[model samples]
Target: MNHLRVSGLRKRYGEQEVVAGIDLELRPGECFGLLGPNGAGKTTTLRLCLGLIDPDGGEIEVLGLPVPARAREARRRTGVVPQADNLDPDFTVEENLLVYGRYFGLRQAEARARIPALLEFAGLSARAASRIQTLSGGMKRRLTLARALINDPDLIFLDEPTTGLDPQARHLIWERLRQLLNQGKTVFLTTHFMDEAERLAHRLAIMDRGRIIAHGAPRELIAKHIEPQVVEVYGDGAGRWAREFGQAHSERCEQTGETIFCYTHDADSLVHHLDQRSGLRYLHRPANLEDVFLKLTGRELRD
Candidate 1:
């Protein structure tokens, strides 16, 4: 059975169309990423898919169950890790899991039976007795992940799963997510970090202003939207170098802040020009998801 199906999905807030006619299909055991900037309706779409909020138009189904009609049943089989941590500071780590278990209609004995394995899975075996205030940020996040799995769900929803995490912590979370995917669990993820999406998502959709602009594997989207090579130059005289040499050498060039991005099919001539120049540093690399995001969404900041 398919993990999820959404067709002609739409949600509006007053006059603003937050989710404007979207459609999606997620296979079982696939990590489907939803990417967008602030106010792009990603969060709204997640709520809609879960039937937490009614859509303005369209249909939703989870595990062959019609949404909002049988949303409670669908949610019983789903685990959700929200963007923010809302763990109760009043409770200890183990207690937190046990309390969440009650919400899933699991008994105390049943919850206790699963705590040890869950703690071990989250690398929080020792922190089980600790209070929420006593744990570090990473520890808290790990605990939240463990709590989401308390129901032994078939599908998991992760909202910006690695936000504000250090590199090491993020990698650890990525590894855990990998393990879940390997276990044949369906993962629906929303994230702003393009690298995270590129690494975790089997296939992804990029949304802008409440609509999907691109959908494919990371490599496919990159190939379709960006040049083969990119050279980023910055430092003193970078602008002058870009104006004088970058335009002549690159197929396309863009200036953002103090950095100049040159997109080209071939970088040999560009590298030669950079080698001849002084007081400028540059990075030469293959075009990636971030390039596609910028090309489609623009580099402007969204609030």
Candidate 2:
């Protein structure tokens, strides 16, 4: 059975319809990503699935159980790493895991037994007695991830799991997530980083203005929505060059600031011209998920 299924899901706030007629399904052991901008209702959808709030319309089934009614029951088998760390300040690293494990109704002995492994999994074995305040940003994030696994859930929800993390920290988290997938765990992820979505999501959905506009395997979506090749020229003369070259050669073109992005089926002419221009900084590469995202969602900044 699918880990999660939502059909015709809808949610509203005052006059605004945040989630509109959404449909989604997650196969077991799949890392499904949900992408969207602020006010896109991504969080609301997560809440609806979790039964943290009731939907205005539609059906949601999590772990084969009907939601809102069995949301609590479904939650027991699902883990969550929220966008913000909620670890208690007073608790030690070990204490935090123990306390969270207790919420799952684990016996003292069982929780204790899991603590050592959980600490080690989080790379905090040496810091077991460390207070939450003493940990760095990355360490805290890892601890939160570890705490979510206190119950050894079958499904995990990670909301912007690497938001404030540095490159090193982000890579570590990615490695850990990979390990969980190897163990056959289903990961439901929400993130704004295109690279992260491309790397981790087996399948993904993109949302805007409270609805899913596009979704598929990263490469599939990229191939379907954008040109295969892209030439990004950025410098003082970029906008002018884009205006001229885009009219004659590119399938599509966009100019932001002093940078010009030319999307085309073939970039040979563009690259040849760029190479002739001295001191012109340009990148020629294959299209990626971000290209598809921008094409479908537009380049306007969301508030």
Where does candidate 2 stray beyond 4 Å? none
TM-score attained by model 2: 0.98
lDDT of 2: 0.91
By how many angstroms RMSD does model 1 differ from the true structure?
Answer: 0.9
Cα lDDT of model 2 by residue, 163-197, tens digit: 99999999999999999999999999999889999
lDDT score at residue 207, model 1, on the 0-100 scale? 96
Candidates' TM-scores?
0.98, 0.98
* Best by the lDDT measure: 1
Against the correct fold, how does model 1 do in TM-score?
Answer: 0.98
Residue 110 alpha-carbon offset, candidate 1, angstroms: 1.5
Q: Candidate 1 lDDT, tens digit per residue, 34-143? A: 99998899999999888899988999999889998899999999999899999989999999999999999999999999999999998999988998999877888888
